[model samples]
Target: MNLVLFDLDNTLLAGDSDYEWGQFLIAKGAVDGPHYEAKNKAFYEDYKTGRLDIYAFLAFALHPLATHTRAQLDAWHAEYMETHVKPMITQTARDLVNKRLDDADLVAIITATNSFVTAPIAREFGIPYLIATDPEEIDGRFTGEVAGTPCFREGKVARLERFLEAHGTHLDRLGSSWFYSDSHNDLPLLEKVQHPIAVDPDTVLHAHALAKNWPVISLRGDQHA
Candidate 1:
């Protein structure tokens, strides 16, 4: 069976979920607005530039989860889904994913954002498989540290390999595979796939996609790249 993978942030959703989550917290007075905004923007810019320090970013990103009770976090996340996340979901993105599902392909979301920020977003997309950074939890409380390799850059490929291997298959075993992403950081898995599609790609990925003759598409636009 063919495998189809999507990058969660700008690829599948119009906005970055992780960054938005932080901003949502700041808006709710859960965090200091100026402080979190600056950090969030800086880290996000670092991410787009391919120089992100994943662990450092995570410690900041997951800190709020550790500070709040699970119940409070859940309540805020529900509001986050409605206020920040839901509007980012576009019709074209949904159609693309649903078509893949209807075609019986193996589909999943692979993201660098911690699962705490991305799990509900994945579920909302109706995609069953998700490979994201895991936040360490003990006794129902977050530790603000990663449980394993963060699914960023090369880590994404490693995690997907493990996931496929566990299913009794590997990347090469799939009849064909497709990875759709927006960031250059996804090049590891994007290059590995038989079909590497760039969706609303950033500068580096756009140039790379052009140089490699790969199809580039944008769900946000009326035209296909």
Candidate 2:
């Protein structure tokens, strides 16, 4: 059976959910205004160029979960989905995902963003499987620590392997595998797939895809292929 994997941020949504989530928190006063927004934007820039330090960024991004209760976080996230994320869910993304879901044996969204921030977004796309970075929990409260690998860069491959194992399958078992992503940070997993689609790629990933003869597509109205 064929396997299909999607990247959540720029690949599916018109904007970056991780960065927007931080801005959402800052606007709600859950995080420091100037300091948090500055670091958030810096981390986003680092991510675009594939120079992000996942550990440092997570420490900053996940801290709010530790300070707030689950209910409070959920309430805020609901608002986030409504106000910020919903508008970014473009028709192109929805159609692509729906088409893939109808064809693929296994469809999954594997993002570097933590599960707490991206789970609802996955649901919005009507995707059932998600492999995202896990935020640590202690006594039913967030610890602001990573559970395992950060699911960034090479960690995405590791996480995907674990997910396949859980389903009594492996990458080799699939007939054809596809991975769509926008960032160079996802190159590790992207290269592993039989079909590597660069969806609205950044500068580095776009050049790399062009050099490697990978199919370049854009769901944001600028179609390369």
Candidate 3:
């Protein structure tokens, strides 16, 4: 048995998941602000670059939702799925997921995206496990805080270790573990995998991928392997 971990944002989807999520919150009446886009973008950039830990990222991402309850955030997530994510599913990524499902591998999504938003995408792709940062709640209301370690950089490897421990799986025991990502920020986790494939990578990651002699793949037209 093996594990196939995938990154959520540009690796699976076409663009920035957090930005889309913030837009979703604004559209759903969950957050009201003219600065939502700029603020969310800045926070997301920092989080992706590993400057923000899991808790800080969630605190900033869902800070707007702090005015509401967890139930309200859940409902807003539903709207987010329908409004922002339902249509952007990439054929190549979907096909890759379907192949993994067919092979019965333990497919997991490891993303820095908030659990509320990433959960829907995981469900859409029929993934069994999701590792993401959770928003802290007190008496059902968001505290504008995050719970547990953030799933970014080395944090992703830590999250994977915990998940495997709970499931009686080990990193070496996976036999042939693989990870797919597009960000240089994911270098820590990518390096840990036996197979690290850089898919449609950005400038910084692409350069590192080349230097490391890692196999780079693309999901765009006429691209594969």
List the candidate 1 regions with Cα displacement exceeding 4 Å: 221-225
Per-residue C-alpha lDDT of model 1 across residues 1-225, encoded as one tens digit per residue:
789999999999898999999899999999988988999999999988888999899989989989999999999999999999888888889889999888756899999988988999989989999999999999999987789999999999999999998888999989989999999999999999999999999999999999999999987844221
Write candidate 2's Cα lDDT for 9-108 as tens digits.
9999888999999989989999889999999999998888778888999998889899999999999999999999988887888889999999998999
Number of the predicted model whose lDDT against the real structure is largest: 2
How does residue 55 of candidate 1 score in lDDT? Answer: 88
TM-score per prediction, in order, is 0.96, 0.96, 0.88
Stretches > 4 Å off in candidate 3: 47-55, 220-225
Distance from true location, Cα of 90 in model 1, Å: 0.6
lDDT by residue (tens digit), candidate 3, 1-225: 788898988888777778887877776666655677677777777755657555555666868767866777777777777767765666787898889777746789998876866887899888989998776767767777778877778888999999988889898888788889999889899989898999899888899899999989875543321
State the local distance difference test value for candidate 2.
0.92
- The candidates, ranked best first by lDDT, are 2, 1, 3
Pick by TM-score: 2 or 3, better one: 2
Better of 1 and 3 by lDDT: 1
Score each candidate by Cα lDDT.
0.91, 0.92, 0.79
Model 2 residue runs over 4 Å out of place are 222-225
